[model samples]
Structures are given as structure tokens and as C-alpha cells.
Target: MSTVVIAPELQKFLEVVRAELSDLDAEEQREITDGLVADLTDLIDDQGIEALGDPVAYAAELRQAAGLVSARKQVRERVAVGIRVHAVLDAAKARCRHVLEGLPGDVDELLTSLQPAWWVVRAYIAVQSVLLSSGGWSLSPVPDDSISGALALLVVVAASVQLGRGRLWPLTRWSGSALLRVVVLAINLIAIGLVPAVAGGFENREWDNYDAGYSDGMNEATGAYAVDDAGGTLFASGLPVGNIYPYDAAGNPLVGIQLFDQHGNPIQVKGKNECVYEGPEEVLTDTSRVFFPWSDGAAQRWNVFPLPSRIQGADVAEPDPTAFTGTNRPAVSGFPFVAVPKVSLPGLLTSAATTPPKAFVPGARTEDVNLVESGC
Candidate 1:
């Protein structure tokens, strides 16, 4: 038989097949390599070597097919992960929407009562700014919460303006209709009451005390003391203590004293001494500086003690001792005591009772107290 010369292109293809089969068993490698050579030769004869396309392209296609199987498996795994992530995100979005929609009708009712005005404008701006900054735009395919909040705020502003203009209870065009007027007035009253109740509930539910002292009591040599609007004690001497330490409203801590009761209750003593430097020691030098002190004293000592007589009355909590700090400052300042009403008393009692007591000893299992005593 005449010797048949292999084309340069066919030689190249065989070389690639040989390299790929190098890692296979000798028998398998020979079988695969020979098969590849024969197939390429037949392809070249059927279509000119050039027409069969680039040798590298053909080799690349084979490599890609082999890798494609592995790649497809990887793609399936990635798709599964993506699906799970999407499902979780979808559930979260639905829950968020439900929460926003479940807001009390009073939220909308209050908005309806508000009269459109500059404060309303400011309120809308504030609400929108909050929503936008909180990722309102990307919340979901539809921004349900952002839209609802905006609409609710708008209604409130409109109602406020109407109430301010005395248009809330307009005299009907029908003359001598006292019955109509009375009915309208009653409806308006009910609506007005509902607005605040709903808004109040929403605020109370969401507003959490940021300071540890506010939520839990501070431990001292004597015992655990509750924090009030005033703050916590800093030193063992009963000086007004703050986490940031001794900074007044102006960021300056004058002469201060901290003391602890025998039971480990921390007491804060502030303000400069009088002419004799022996006058009555004041608890706070300024009203803003006065905080609730936790003690084992009677309920009256607590801020929420003493229920008020009327529901519409002011809170009967103790006034801050540091409220006024000028020349007329009292020798010992404390919050003005107020009466607590049933509505306020129930909440106060519930909070106090539910709150766990602080631990007396350090490293104890107490949930309420985090004593960072100095020199301990």
C-alpha cells in the first residue's frame, strides 16, 4: 500500500489527544488516542482539514464538553443556594409588610385629625427621610411600608390642620339641627381619642431603653440601684456616675461625690458646697443631671409610685432634683412628686415586677445588674 502522508493539522490533533490520554491506563490511553486519531482523519477526509475548523478550537470544544458536566453540577448547586436565599428574603419581606399593615387604625385616624401645616410638613419630611435611610427603596418589589407610613403621616398632618382651623366640627348647612351637631361632636371625640391610643402603643412598643442603667440596675457596695432619667452612680462614694464619667451638660464635672448604702445601693451626690461647705448635700446640681436612684426604700421612693387621681392628669412621678441649677438651687434637689393614675400605674407595676432584681454579689447569675465597680 502506498504510504499516506498525515496532514500537519491532523498531526496536531493527534498530539493533543495523546497528551490528554497521558494520565489514563496504558490500555485505555491507547484505545482513546487511536480512536481520536481515526475520527479526526475521517473528519478531515470528509471535509478539508481547514474546513474542519481550527485544531485548537476542536480540542477546546472537547475540553469544554468534559468540563461542562462538572460545571453543570456546580451551576445546579449555585441555583439551589440562590433559590433558598430568595425564599428567605421573600418571607422576610412578607412579614415586614404584615407588621406595617397591622399598625393600629388610630395611626391613620390621628393623621386624618391633623390639620395640614408646617409641622405636618416637617413630620412628613422626617418620616420620608427615615424610610429612605432605612432602605425603603429596596424593601421589596413594592415599598409597602414606606408608602403606608407616608400616607398615614399625610393624613395626620391634614387632620391636625383641620383641628387647628376649628373646621374639625363644622356646623352643618341644615339649620336648627342640634342633634346632628351633637352626633358629629361625639364622633370627633371618639376619633381623637383613638389616634393617641394607637400612636402611644406603637411608640411604647418600639422604644427600648438604650442605656443599661435604664433597663437594669447598677450594682454598688450597698446593693443594686435602679437608674432613672437622671443616670447611674459612678463611684463608691455615691457620686453621680455616668459611663462617660463626670461630664455635665457642658461636658465638665465639677466637685462630685458618689456614695453607696450599706446594701450596695449607689447614691449620687453632686453640686458645690455652700458657704460653710457643710450645708445639706444635694443629689443633683442640675435638673437634667438628676437620675432615678434605686434603693430598698418604699414604693414612694420609686419614680412611678403614687397613682394619680385622674386619667387626664399629669404624671405623679418625682421631679428631678437637678432640674433647676441657678442661684435658687435647693439644698437637696429631687424630682417633683406626681400622682400616678390607674392607666400609668398598671404599666409601671408590670414593668417593675417583671424586671428581675439585680445580683448582690459580683460574678453572680443576676440578669439586671452589671456592676463595674472602681478598684474591684
Candidate 2:
């Protein structure tokens, strides 16, 4: 092997190559650098460094030839993949910088030239503030329906006003007189802070009232329940004065259904949706439906009521004393009924004309007797 003396400039060029090829493995980097040093040592002796062109650019070309990424490009690509969010932000910043750089002058001068567009943004922000205060408008950068929205408006107003006067800060405007600027700055801060607080306070008041109204309306719709066991608890077929429609295990309507009591006598629902003894003159209201103790014994109705209507307590049909077996015969004193005034009058008239009279008064056995007699 011949001894080769590498020149300082050639060594420096090889170092640059090493740096450019740093993304490659140590063994791969050494192989590329050693090959380049061996070949380029004689080239440098024959032709000066100038003939080889810029070292960095030459190193980049060499890196590409070796199927390796250059140091700067590799770093950028790695960062781009690793921090995708930052990459997007950097692209946006670069675009903005390019747009600003394309303008007639530098940053401050460009801002002054594009004053009209900035003012338009400021004006739009101000209009949004007015709408937000009135509870009519909301958008991003300022969270909707939040106290922070008011604060955001104040900040935008402050920045916009300063920008309109070709200044960044209120104090900087009166920079010639430090004391005067300080006083004005303090006063401006006070005004900005106070205005939003006061405005937002009023807006908050309106929203608070709206929320409270909805809450109170819900509370009023669900009336309280009351039970009076006057007749006794046990009955044969129909439920106590409150249960509107009775259903069996199979969900079949108990109306006109025959059921036998503990004594095994055939009990038939003759008419009026109540149970009558086959052999005797006694009438019965079914006591099987018990009040759920969990809801403070509150009565429940189906969600059949139309919305935007109030619910109120209404008087039910008076209880019959002779129907039940136990002394704890319960009566539903009040039923929470939907009071849609628009529908109630017409509904009541239709019900009165169509519904059987015995459905309204289950205690009346005269109709049941006539039905049983007719059937027999």
C-alpha cells in the first residue's frame, strides 16, 4: 500500500462530507468518507479547491449519489415527521412571511401598507364583540357562551385600537412624554377592563333568567301526589280510582276480562271496566296496583302530553266506600294532568260524547247489572 498525505483543505472537505452523511450508519459513513478522501486527495493536488465548487453543495451532491440524505434535509424531514403540528405552523408562518416580504418594504413598513386589510379584520372582530355581548353571535378564537368570551373581546379591542394608530401598545403612542403615556396607558387599561365586565354582567343576567325560567317551568309541570285509603286495599278486578287503564301480564287490556279471586268464583267484568261477582250483587275495584314507594308515592303518567304546556293537579272521581276488601282502601285525591288549554276544552267535549259514562263513574253498578242481565 502506498502512503498518501491528505492536504488540510481536502481533509476539511472530507469533514464536510462526513457531516452531510451523518444520517448514515457509522460503518457506512466511514466507507463513503474513506472512498472520497482517497479519490479527492489527488484531485485537490491537481486542481485548486475553487474548481470543485462550494463544499456544502458538493457534499450534498455526493450524499445524493450515495443514496443518502444530506444532514440539513434529513434533519428537516425528521422534524417534519416527528412534529407534524409544528410543521403545519411553520408552513403557515413561511407563507405569511413570503406574503409580507413580497410587499414594498420590511415588516413594520409592510404592516403600514396593508393597514386597510388589518383594519377590516379589526372591524369584523369589533362587530363580533357587539353580537356576543347581545348574545346573538359567537365564533372561534373566542369560546362560545363563556365568560372568557368577554375577556377576548376586550383584548381584541385593545390591540385593534393600538394597531389603527400605527402603534402596537397604548403606552408607545405617547412615548415622547413617558409620564403622560404611563397615565394614558393606565386609564386605557381601566376602561378596557371595566367595559367588558359591565357589559358581560348584563348579558349574563339575561341568560341566568332564561335558565331559571326553564327550571321553574319543569318543577311546576310535575305536581305532588296524595293517597287516601278510604275504601280498603284489596279488590277483585278494576284498580282504585286513579289507574286509567289496567293491563294483564300479557299486556292485554283487563276490560271485560274474567278473573277468579282466592275463593275461585268466576268474576266477570260486566261493563264500566270494573269487576262484578257472578253470584252476588257486590262490586270490586282491583287493588293489585300499588304505589311505588321510591318516588315518595308520587303518581306517574305516560309521556303523552304535548310539549310547551303546563301540568297541574286535577280532582279525580270520588272513591266508593263499598268496593275493596281491606280497611286501607286508597283513593287518588289528585292526578297530575297535562293542561294544554288549546286542546283541553275540545278533548273534554270529545271524551264526554264518546267515552262510556261507566268509565267515569266505576262505582255505579246499575249499568254493570244491566250488562250482565243482557248477557245472561
Candidate 3:
């Protein structure tokens, strides 16, 4: 390559300008200096040495013309800002350390010693991320009793621990890279985001164990599970009661009786139009017979006592879902008991009628036999 020679004065001026601009990034410096040697040679050949002027002022003018910052001023401003930030961070860190150290029972040391605990936490969470990403909302973070789950947890936890200890692949080789730091931060955020779901999953984990119309401790009769189990159900003799019967002191069936637990939660049930029955000591067979559940003017309320029953007939306002497609079956629902005998009235409720409020006292069965034998 042939060298283009320049006058000593012009060469000296370019060198001085380059030196003044040393603090700018390489690309910015190259933008100002790329063709300068040849351009400066031509300029000096035309306008004698007087056009060169002071090199520092020339560098500043070139930077301004190119829309770049004045390098010396930028360096000074950055260094001053860095010093302030550094001092603030150091003071804050020291204050935190002092406050922690002053707390009861070596709090600072305890936190430092708990680094491995964080490793365990993040390890569980990292494994949790895979499950969450794969379409599980309510699930155990560390799934138990399964080889796939246990092995995944073991592998992730070991990797997470090694990463925290700076011994894993990316940690050992590329810890200083900004992209790697961002990836690590994103992984941490995802893990934190799944924390609530993991907790909720455990709280309602019985649903996960449900199978074939049976849940934990469920009997074949009255065996069913609901999400947020107790919230939407009533229990009698420790099993789920699908519906309740409420009879008045006169043995009259009551409908639309809003019931609640002691906690004041509205008792509700799932399933749109669940099959239910009535009549004491009757064979509880499901039929096309309908029950008109109460509506708070919005949706059907199944918890209302004595869900009124009738046969499918010509008067139902809505179509039957079980009917053939595009045709509404004639389904009718009505109050099953509009009237009954009164206990307080003369001859209305005889002693032969069922006892009022329908609860048997202790040994009432034996007493009933005794009364029948005595012919009272």
C-alpha cells in the first residue's frame, strides 16, 4: 500500500485532535477520524498551516458538528455522577448492614448463612416454572410420588444450587455478560410469579387425587368433590349433602329457604340442574321429574330448601337441555307441598302424624315401640 504523505504541522495537528478525542467510543472516534488524514493533507496544501487552528477546539467543533458529545466534558460529568451514585449506594449498603447487625440474634449473619436456603427456594421455583409453562395452574411445585417429578426437581435444584454458587455452565463462564444477567433476572421473576399458584394448589390438592367418582375418604354413596370444597356444600353425618329438606312445625315443606353456614357463606352447589329427590324413605331413583330451584332473579339457586318438584309438562318457560337437539321437551316444575296438616290445630295433626320439627330424642325409637305396645 502506498502511503499518502502529509505536512509535519498537519500530522501534528491531527495527532493532537485524536488525543483530545480519546475518551469517545471507538465508533464515534472512527466517525470523526475515518478520512481525516487525507482530508487534512488536502486542506493544508490549499490553505497553508493557518487553517488548522487549536487542536482541542477543533476536536470539540468536530464533535459538535457530528452531533457527538464533547468527550472531556462528558467524561468529567460521568465520573462525577458515578462518584455520587457510588457514595449513595455505599452509604445505603452500610446503613442496611448496621441495622441488620443491630437487630436481635445476629440477623445479618443469619441472612448470609441462609444463601443455601435461597438456592433451595429458587431451585423449587425453577422446577415449578417448567410445570407452569406446560399447562398446569394448580399443581405442586415439588410433585411427590412420581419418578418424573422427583427427578426433574432433583436435577433443577442441583443446577440452581450450583448456579447460585457460581459453578454452573453460564455462571462459571459468562456471569459478566449483560445478556446473561437479564436471562437470570427473567428466570427469577417467573419463579416468583408462580408462588401464589403453588400455594393454592396445595390448599386444594384433593381435587388432584380425585378419580372415578371418588375423592379422598369418599363413599360410593354421596361421593363428590367441589373446588374450594366447604365453600359450596353442606355436610350431614360427615358426608356431602346434595340437598336439604326443611319441614315446618306443621310438617309443611318449605321452599326458597336461604341457608348459610356459621361463617355466613352462601351455601351453593356446582352442576347446572343437578338431579335431586324428595319424600322420606322413598327409593331415591332419578327420573324426568323436575324441581323448580329458586332464582335470585339471575341464576338458579340450588341451596334453597325443598327444591319444588313436578313432571315435564306443557308450562316450563325454558327448554330442556336433555331434550333432542333444536327441540324443547315439555318439562314442568312446581312446589311439591302447597299444604299439610297443622300440629297446633284440633284434629289437623293427630298424635299419629310425624313429630313436629322431626328430630328424635335419645332412645325415642325404644319409646316408640313401648308406646305402640301400650296402645297409647
Model 2 CA deviation exceeding 4 Å by range: 7-9, 19-28, 41-53, 71-241, 245-376
Comparing 2 and 3 on TM-score, the stronger one: 3
lDDT of 3 by residue, 1-376 (tens): 9877778898789889998888788999999898988887777789878988899898888888888876568768866876675566568769999999878998888888997888788888666656656776556535644788989888888998887676787567765444455566676677788778676666556566564236545633444443344446544444444345554666555534677768986666431232223443342233323434566878767666644433333233233445434344322223234445655765564333442332211111111111010111
Top lDDT prediction, candidate number: 3
Q: What is candidate 1's lDDT per residue for 27-108, written digit by digit as tens?
A: 7555434566567777778887766565545655565554423344466787687667556656865786666567976554
Backbone clashes (count) for model 2: 5
Residue-level lDDT of model 2, residues 228-304, one tens digit each, is 25422222222223123333333222232223558964322211122333446644332111221101136322211
* TM-score of structure candidate 2: 0.29
RMSD of each: 25.0, 17.6, 14.4
Please report, in order, the local distance difference test score of every candidate based on alpha carbons.
0.41, 0.45, 0.60
Tell me the lDDT of model 1 at 86: 58
Query: What pairs collide in candidate 3?
Result: none
List residue ranges in candidate 1 displaced over 4 A.
1-34, 50-376
Query: How well does model 1 score by local distance difference test?
Result: 0.41
Q: Which run of 10 residues does model 3 get worst, by summed lDDT?
A: 366-375
TM for every model, in the order presented, reads: 0.18, 0.29, 0.42
